[model samples]
Target: MTDTMNAVAYSHALPIDDPTSLEDVTLPVPAVGPHDLLVKVVAVSVNPADVKVRSDMDPDGVPTVLGFDAAGTVAAVGSDVTLYAVGDEVYYAGAMGRSGSNAELQAVDERIVGTKPKSATFAEAAALPLTTLTAWEGLFDKLKLTAESMGTLLVVGGAGGVGSMIIQLLKARTPGIRIVASAGREASQEWVRSLGADEVVRHGEHLTEDVKRVAPEGIDYIYSTNTVGQMDAYIEILNPFGEIVATDNPGLVDLGLFAGKSLSWHSELMFTRSVFTTADMVVQHELLTTVGEMMDAGTIRSTMTSAFSPLNAEQLRLAHASVETGRTLGKVVVTNEPLAS
Candidate 1:
């Protein structure tokens, strides 16, 4: 194994176009903690959090390594690690507190790692963990929507990474729930429709009119991806005692709107459980493993829409730029050249 590896890092906040925004640096392999597994990363995926963190780098501190999702082979395990061993293929979203998966090697908690789906390449598997966890918690834990709940559901921002996964998971598990996804572009509209959205509507233009075109009454649940400001408009079209869930933190929304409709609002942050080290933290591992099984069984498919080779500074910058546009259809992954095949 190599003693030092290449990584993309940033020392200060800068625009994506700035040549110094991201730099290729060599770093020593991190040692595993008592409950950690040392993984040799083969592929990594960029998320909105990666971009946000990179763009908001501290000018005084050390350069921050940014990457959340990774798929790799376990190279070694801490003495306390029992779930995974050397040579096991695993995929996971690294915790936010430590160094991330941007390097050639990463140390992740064994509890959060899961066996990669046999049907997917490392790049494909790398695209899933973060988004899948967020979507799963939002639907199952936050909104409390079960498979038996037979009602109409609305997924806002349906073409993006989290949106795509949410649609697939909901359709696969909750067979009785009807899904209507909102997308503005033609390509996105078709993408969500193909992913099992019973209907697709244009967002930001006429949400109520479009919902009327499909189901005139109102949806039973609304999953807003990043549109907290639009919750008022959606609440107007929600059924009495219905629920609304959002992953984005749009501060200080008017609660009065939901009170009148007898609607409930929920906030879902996938990192909350991990960040707090809650008692149920292992549930993330269970959910990710379940998602892997579902993928291997052909119940759901990888939502990666784009791929880049040789995980490097330039490629990551490009990926970040795409995500910042907020219109990417699905996940964007970057794989080491040796693993891309």
Candidate 2:
């Protein structure tokens, strides 16, 4: 193996349009840890977290690799790694504290990695880990939803990557639960509906009315992707003792909004398990494996909407641009290979 390999990194946070914001450089291939898998990344997907980190991280003049979701093959495994072996195909969302998947090779913990779906292409599989983990953790771990769970779920920004997974996970895991997804555009509305949202409504000013019209009695749960400015609408539509789970930072909001009805709020960050080195961090591997089974069984589908290839600085830049548009239908993937056309 080469001592150094090509990677896309940013030394400073800047707009995506800036040439230096993401640069092609060479860095040492990460060494495998005690429980690590040395993976040759085949493809990667861009997420809002990538955008936020690129714009917010103070790299302090050090080039920082910035990718979270990836699908790859294990080229080597650490001596203590029991979960995977060299030559095994795997997928995972990288830990926040570690170097990311933008590079040709990445060393990630085996506990968080899952077998890539046999039915999925590398680009398609790369789109699953981050969003899938976030949605699963939100619904099962935090929301404590079960197969027998019953209620109307209001998914704010349903056409998004995370929202898309939330809707499908609810459908596959809780068959009786009703899902109402909110989207502002016709295409987005259709997109969410196609993903099994029982009801679709325009977001923004009409949020309450749209939710009320479909749910009538108020929503029992809320999964919001963009929580920054939607607290008021969430407070209005949620039922007494209801719950809200969000994947994004809400910034400053009136916490008292939940007090009125004894409502509860939960924040879901897939990175929490890896970031804190939690005891049950391997749950990500379990859930991702389940998702892969579901994929092979045709119960769910990949959300990749756009694709770019040959994983490089320019491709990463285009993928980031697609995510920054805030209107990407599903996920935008960058692969090490060309599209089949």
Which number leads on TM-score?
2
Q: What alpha-carbon RMSD in Å does predicted model 1 have with respect to the real structure?
A: 1.6
- Please provide TM-scores, in order, for all candidate models, with all chains considered together: 0.96, 0.97
Write down the lDDT of every candidate, Cα atoms only.
Answer: 0.87, 0.91
Kindly report which residue pairs in candidate 2 clash with one another: none
Residue 310, candidate 2: C-alpha displacement in angstroms = 1.3
lDDT of 1 by residue, 16-85 (tens): 8888787889888887789899999999999988988888766455766889899999998998988888
TM-score of 1: 0.96
| Residue 205 lDDT in candidate 1 | 54
Model 2 lDDT, residue 126, Cα = 96
